[model samples]
Target: DKNEKIYVSYDSTNKNCKAGDIEMAEYGHPKNDVGAPIINYSIAYDMTNEKPLLYESYPGSIVDVSQLKYMLEKIRGYGYKKIGFILDRGYFSKANIQFMDSCDYDFVMMVKGRASFVHGLIMEHMGEFESKRACSIKAYRTYGMTVKAKLYADDETDRYFHIYYKAKKQASERARLEADLDRMEAEMDKIKG
Candidate 1:
């Protein structure tokens, strides 16, 4: 069985450009202090084949989430059918969710941060699997991909969510918080001195 599942991931990246190199790009924040013109573009990547399916350029002045609608339509023009999208949490929104559903696309998007329901879910079930050894999983550069998932629905919207309990991810997140607190304390010490 050589048949492979078709999965596409949509992501946008910012690039440096000349002042008038692109028509739509403007002086937008590029997450850097570089005083140069920038351009933003979205690429639909075929994760199964490790190739890019479609790409759409955009004005650099726009944020990533703001370009989702345009990117969706641009890829649709490429005439790919029955393709599923795996998107990052940054693309989560009521409008985006509705748009994907309207387009009849199978989509699996990562949920970000605390929606009230997600928080409640965590509170309700996190204690059930609190040990690192219980859900220890190796993923990417960390042992943190182990997850327990549950289907969730938003009361205010029709969007359904899958909440995951990732122990290694949680550990990594706690390390990040510890780092931030360390930095803040160091700053306070410097100021006091």
Candidate 2:
């Protein structure tokens, strides 16, 4: 099972509990409108088997970004070598990327579109694969192209970025942005009047 893929995600939800001796019950970011104490928990899921491999609960004050290293270590302790992780944008950070590199773990993470590194890459490779039929993924209805580059200027390792684009999504986002701009302009005009 060394070659099996594992997708890890960390999330927490609030639990409404009275003032009691529950050690992990503390106030943190509430995922819902529960006006009570909360506890943060995370699960490491095995993607290949579609089941949870491990779970851990911690104090509510702990954030998900800070738990990546701990979770990676726990997974390693379970004797899983050659691990692959699929993470969300919240886990995308320079330190996390470097740590994963050090551990020799493979990861596919979502990066914020507005990040300067991502923006630069998009601009550099714009239109290269947008219309290329060879890059089209019919099932996902998106065009994907992989580029190998350093995640940071000082990094010694090169990472593979699977950049994807969908024309319909782009058009929809553009329209929404235009509508927001028009609304803001109208509000400004009213203020001036």
Candidate 3:
């Protein structure tokens, strides 16, 4: 098992909790409901074993982007070498990326599609691999292509951007957008009346 690549998925969620002796249970941005004390719970999950490797609790006021360095240090302290990370969009930030790069850890992070750099990449590479059978990932039922570039202007390392397209997901998202637009239009008409 030591020779195998270790991949961990890191994510966090807020849970409503009573603020008694627990100092971390403070009111912050609640993911579920507003105006309640919450505690942030994060987990590092072993992707290969399909189980959690570790969990940590932190103040709800702390954002995900700020916790990456601390979590990475803790993980490394556990004697895990040759580790890779699968991170969510909330953890995507210049500082976090740089910290990970400094530690020399491999990671795949979800980038916001609306980010200018990401949008530009999508526009530049649009339609290049979507219809190609060779680009299809059968297991995920999606088409994917990779782009290599520096994340920062002065970075010594080249980062790879894996762009994927799923037709079913796109159709579902479009339907949701249309429904939302219809509802907004009706609300505006009622307000005008």
Candidate 4:
């Protein structure tokens, strides 16, 4: 199904221009301050819903967990509880994850490589599945469970918990592709010359 949608990005700086402010040039005019004095807003609209839900916003360069929690609470007050929170890689910190866990919220967060250090306990358990030819890992926590899924590249059905093996193979394939491309480019240059 196709639906028509329009989105607006709201900011805190929308001020009306007065003749005196324009003439005096001391207070910034409306043109100078594009959207001043308004609250920041992000909204996602579903045609089925009677009203749009305000999903996200960032007032400044950095947003702390407290600011996010306040924004979410305000949104939840409007009767939107089934919320999915998303953040850029810059906001991928241990403190933020802990906050999410404490608040009993589910989030789809960008997992930066460095953030994996927080899951060192999981990494340490990798060796337990080394001998198994095919396996998957399931982790239990007081809150919920995590499943580390793996599948074979050659055969989709043949999945295993060989983390190191998969990572090394992927890297090797990438290196091989780069080498092949370099060789092919050299050949192309020779033919052109």
Q: For model 1, how does the per-residue alpha-carbon lDDT over 36-146 read when each residue is reduced to its tens digit?
A: 777887788988888988887887788887788887787677676666899887687778877877887778877654777567666766655454554443453322222
Candidate 1 Cα lDDT to native: 0.70
Q: Output the TM-score of candidate 3.
A: 0.83
Writing each residue's lDDT as its tens digit, candidate 4 over 102-142 gives 54455554444334442553476655544344443323111
For residue 28, what is the lDDT in candidate 2? 74
Greater TM-score among 1 and 3 belongs to 3
Q: Which candidate is the best by lDDT?
A: 3
- Cα lDDT of model 3 by residue, 30-60, tens digit: 8887677889989999998888989999998
Give the Å shift of residue 182 in candidate 4.
Answer: 13
CA-lDDT, candidates in order: 0.70, 0.82, 0.88, 0.43
Superposition error at 118 for model 2 (Å): 0.9
Clashes of each: 0, 0, 0, 7
Per-residue lDDT of 128-164 in model 2, one digit per residue for the tens? Answer: 9998999999999999899999989999988888888
Residue 79 displacement in candidate 3 (angstroms) = 2.5
Which stretches of model 1 miss by more than 4 angstroms? 1-5, 18-21, 33-36, 132-193
- Indicate the residue-level lDDT of 119 in model 2: 89
After superposing candidate 2 on the true structure, give the runs of residues whose Cα lies further than 4 Å from its correct spot. Answer: 1-21, 32-37, 188-193
